[model samples]
Target chain A: MSASLKSLPSNPAFTLPQSNDVQGTTSASGPHIPAEFEQTLTLLTSHRSVLGYLLLSRSQPVSIIRHSGVVFEGEQGRKYAHAVGRIVETVQAGLEEVAGESTDTDEIRFMRIRTKRHEIMISPDERFLLAVLHDPTS
Target chain B: MSASLKSLPSNPAFTLPQSNDVQGTTSASGPHIPAEFEQTLTLLTSHRSVLGYLLLSRSQPVSIIRHSGVVFEGEQGRKYAHAVGRIVETVQAGLEEVAGESTDTDEIRFMRIRTKRHEIMISPDERFLLAVLHDPTS
Candidate 1:
């Protein structure tokens, strides 16, 4: 996998120390994120099934940052952060089956799957991958 | 991280050689899946944004099978099947932060997150977890 496995801080202390404070990095990258990402987040959160979301940039530094729009904390926060990176790698590796000869539409925009106890949602682009975990029953 | 890394068959040939036919094992386990699980799958697929879904059991055998209620196939089929086994393992390892000494309520039932390009929805239960992957853009 090309992704780095750096663990995100349990809190905000893990912010990058470089000239780009977390917010600057986030906004500069924010335009790259689509508008619908949050619209869907609103839909899921309104349903109360959503736990939280993590945004990971594959560009560099391999960041595992939580979505500022929602309150994702504690053990659950860390778990989603970790899952985002792995999911991106897995999808990237697995895409060989679909990419075919068309290089233009090679990126994966979204994916959803379930485990015995929880649901996982993922959206990816050239620069970052976004994942949402939620349950409709809750 | 208690999740077993057992690989789900890349193809149907990997079916458990242990006296279980494909249909037999599914029906034996089918009773555990919630009606709400399918309901959500229907909702997501109905939306043009939905790409596909994979439902996996946390119990042994790490099956990466799709539900009978939903038709998940084509290029995405191969991708999610490949993903199921790895995702279960990832989530299990990631859950350490939240599954504390608290009561039943401490565990998360549902979660949703998104990045700029995609969205992932997850619903988890004691017996299994259901995940739906979709794009609001599509």
Candidate 2:
């Protein structure tokens, strides 16, 4: 994953809309994803199988930092975001319960969910949660 | 996955303890996993990286049909089972919401979650839910 991020350092054509103004701003309102991360999103969405991608702030009152494609537009985006939050929380809590400890070292890294029509790949971190939906068979 | 099931027909040495009594019973009380599934579980547990697996009956009361390894023993198994239910439900609901329809055609097929120490793979169906936990690095 880090290799992919480093691969595309300055893909101007792939620069995201939100990254334009909030390049380095880390306001308390929401997270400030690095330019490399945005490039990675762009690279991921460029795949023919990929339908869209959603990047969310993982802090309290999770917020959508950036979203791409039609599937994650309007109310549907909010619904998917909420689902992501719940799924992450459930898995993290379950892991902690199994370990019987809440150590910082133990945390979720990735999730891949395959449905009838789409495959959702999620990368979760301390500050951001990224989900990419794609057609696996394609 | 299907190939693995076909590989093992009856390995008495690896046959789970439950399979001995509930070989061909599918009572309304709980799910009746086929003999092949039990063999698959046996095959999976034989892997050095695998920590455990939980096979749950996805019915009204969601009972555990079979579980392997110490990681999934006792109350810990119950917690993981509950988490699986919630994760499946949340993802299924989110998919339906995105499609804007409650079509039976749209449903979750599989989920793989990765944490710091373990990688959990879940296969959910109408009658059964199976989860396998393993150490990815190993």
lDDT of each: 0.46, 0.70
Best by TM-score: 2
Instruction: Specify the poorest-scoring 10-residue window by lDDT in model 2 chain A.
Output: A6-15
What is the lDDT for B18 in model 1? 20
Q: Once superposed on the true structure, which residue ranges of model 2 sit more than 4 Å away at CA? A: A1-25, A28-30, A101-105, B1-25, B102-105
TM-score (C-alpha) between model 1 and the true structure:
0.41
Q: What does candidate 2 score on TM? A: 0.77
Deviating ranges (above 4 Å) for candidate 1: A1-44, A59-71, A97-106, B1-138
Best by DockQ: 2
lDDT of 2 by residue, B34-105 (tens): 776767787788877678888887764567888998978998888788777767777776677666765564
Please provide, for model 2 over A64-90, each residue's C-alpha lDDT reduced to its tens digit, 9 standing for 90 to 100: 889998988978888888778777877
